[model samples]
Target chain A: MVDVVKFSGEKEKFNPNKILKTLKRAGASREQSRRILKDVESSLKDGITTKEILDRVFSGLRETPGIAAKYDLKRALMALGPGGYTFEKYFAEVLKHYGYEVKINQLIKGKRIMQEVDVVAKKDSTYMVECKYYNYPGNYASTKEAMYTYARFLDTNSRMHNFDFPWLATNTKCSWSAIEYSKGVGLKITSWKYPAKESLQRLVEAKKLYPVTVLKTASKFVKQRLLDSGIIMINTLMEMDISELRRKANLSESELKKAILEARQISV
Target chain B: MVDVVKFSGEKEKFNPNKILKTLKRAGASREQSRRILKDVESSLKDGITTKEILDRVFSGLRETPGIAAKYDLKRALMALGPGGYTFEKYFAEVLKHYGYEVKINQLIKGKRIMQEVDVVAKKDSTYMVECKYYNYPGNYASTKEAMYTYARFLDTNSRMHNFDFPWLATNTKCSWSAIEYSKGVGLKITSWKYPAKESLQRLVEAKKLYPVTVLKTASKFVKQRLLDSGIIMINTLMEMDISELRRKANLSESELKKAILEARQISV
Candidate 1:
């Protein structure tokens, strides 16, 4: 076991199973994963940061093209915006994919006022999820934001928007205080890395619902332009032929060829 | 009587007594108020805006030197500060003068988080006021703001901050929707002209607690500078000798003399 420093400053002996599990989740073959793990372990220095180790593993996944994209889901989710339906629409699609009837940016009329709810979904129970998307790296959602969002839900939840549950969905982690208060008040939250097996990251990975921005074949600038034009999901981009994709999104022939190749790989 | 259009676009026969009453309230003697009202009415045309009448009346008060300053109280309160104590300090002093022990910018700890309450006051009951000061003309507080404030109060009011009453104090009006929701949620509000008898303007005038910026004698630039330096109260400036006043505020000899003379006029 190699001694490693985690992101939170915890010193731990690195477990091969952890990286191996992630590699398997990213759809890399068992032999390919073991070989990459061996190469990483060979180069690892004791007390090296988890960040460094993850970066190495991330670059190592490029050997398999689309597999690396699946592991880069967190960045892709955060990259889901500044466009009209990239974040909220993406979340709504994810909800719909899970068999929940969904509404995006619905204007809700309460007893006294009209407020817009980001994503309202219902399955066994109705839930209104307020999406807080921030692009700043490592910026945790503040306690005030969680409280404010919950307060709006509470203020109007009395007679309108009759959501059985109030949930805050964010692309970033929430502050510890926000988490504690949210739990105390019964306001459920889903963030990039929170709530364990049901975190935003976990949910996306479990479902294999990768955003088009995740594809390594697409340049960041081209991906952003495509995202701007509202072609966010890899499934949507994969379904479009090269001519249709060119008509919808400004992509060069070579870029289109590579993107389609990776999209196909990811689809498999 | 003149047919005048008010700000709200209502056409009504203007009541001279209304202007007379405001003049009297501004500390003008009945005889002076009657003469000024006569001048204002003579100049008013049919379908004239209430704003035109108010402006003429405002300029009319300049002849009385300090009397116009009292009438300019609403603008003065709104003009309170871009400085440290200009708005919050002025409000705290106004509350303190009215027998509420006040704290400005208190870092209040809620059950799970520490939040800043703008002004916390204790009178017959403990109250926390969130002051929404907007310098823009006619910008009303929104329902979202009111709900967010009350939500924070509710979130932490169970154990800490101990505020028995919650208030959203603003320099501008609260939108009708905001007002209704705030009332529905039991969140009190005070704006420039609200609650009829005890609005911010009424409270300031009832105690003759005029800010330094209310002085028409001082140039707007000079008054803003003085407000920036925290010499906001005219009474404080009035009590100081001209040299001391000059030392404390960046007032020239001429400005100091005029400000003191007007301050004395209002003082009486």
Candidate 2:
């Protein structure tokens, strides 16, 4: 057994089962998951840092053709970042692909005051989505965010013609109390791996609308450029030819080809 | 001479001097301003509502060829409404016209947390301008606003590279204490006719960047449409051809002509 240096600098016995579980959760095949776990175990030294272990696992997964494309989806989502605006934009694009007419950063006129809505989506009825992006995965959308969304909904309900649905979308999960309060107020919630069917993961998988940040092959600069151009979803890049994509995104030949391949494989 | 009802419902003596003062402030020639005031005095009736008096004056100003287009610059500015966002946008445009690169609703990362700056402007140095737009001209920006702006400045100064100037820009006057506190903290302030030379009115007149809402002839819908399309300044409307303005704003022929005439007059 190898000793793993935790983020806090504390050493702990490395658990191969944890890597296997993470690989399985990422939709890796049973055989491939076990093989990657073996690779990670072999690479781990007596006092390997947790980050090094993760790097080894990511590299080992990339070597596998079937699950390599989806290896960083969870990490990439986390990378969408310290600011909530980008997450809101990416989620708006996802909802748009799911057939909702979405407007992001909308200044909605409430009865008493003005509200800046993250994303106002319209289909059968209007849905106001509040996106909460957390840089750290451990952080959860709390009751404060839910309560604020509820207050905004109450203020804007009269202005909306159709039935107003207040929804909270977050890259991370919500606190138990937040979920309870949201349910009490009839506020819909979509967080990572929550709500089973309507979670963010499920929604993205159902529509194959992955954010550009989720591309493992793309660098931070490339992701930012794509986001700035309103190309948040991987499917948007897939719709364009390789030459056009390269030219528009200012990507090198190798970067473009790798991005397209990863996007196509993961989306499929 | 006729009687005019005040906002408090008191029957007040009709004063043509008041009208003359307003016209002169709006940059009307002395002779034309007196004539317009005389016309307003003739139109005033016994126990006339303040609204009726304003309507008559606006109508009378519209008849003048030279300054008719610039009539109601002050009133229209006040009409930018019950909300502060429009005022912020208008002031930002005014600053932009003054050669300052302006950004509205910018999230500035502070030392402790994030601060939402109403207007971040840069020329020789960075100026963070907090706009306090009160619908009722009587409502002055109080000490609370000044203190909050000063607090934000302290938090943002270390983050800015250049000399940071904290400014408070309001559509109305600041309270006495607010002025005193601002002076103590070296915070620059611009209010309606307060600073005399550097006031909001002065800035608007210097650049001739009046907001579209100042047009007494334009309907609420037309003004809102113009605002939504990022056409805040009166000069922006003047730059467009009448045909394009009518098509884009979806204005009636009369409304289009009146708006264009007023925009062209005021900008010149």
B202-260 in candidate 1: lDDT tens per residue?
Answer: 88778778898788878888887778777778877876677766777766888788777
Query: Which window of 10 residues has the lowest lDDT sum in candidate 2 chain A?
Result: A154-163
TM-score of chain B of each: 0.83, 0.80
Query: Candidate 2, overall lDDT?
Result: 0.74
TM-score of candidate 1 versus the correct structure, residues matched by position? 0.68
Runs in model 2 lying further than 4 Å from the true structure: A1-18, A25-27, A41-52, A160-163, B1-268
Q: Model 2 — TM-score against the truth?
A: 0.47
Per-residue alpha-carbon lDDT of candidate 1 for residues A1-268, written as tens digits (9 for 90 to 100): 6789875577899888888987888888889898889878987888988778778887778777778888767667767765435688888877777898998888887766777888898999888788888754556787767877787787557553578878888888888888988887788898887998888877777776778878887788888877777777777777777787887787787887887788888877
Model 1 per-residue lDDT at A112: 64
Worst 10 residues of 1 chain B by lDDT: B77-86
DockQ for each of the predicted structures, in order?
0.40, 0.01
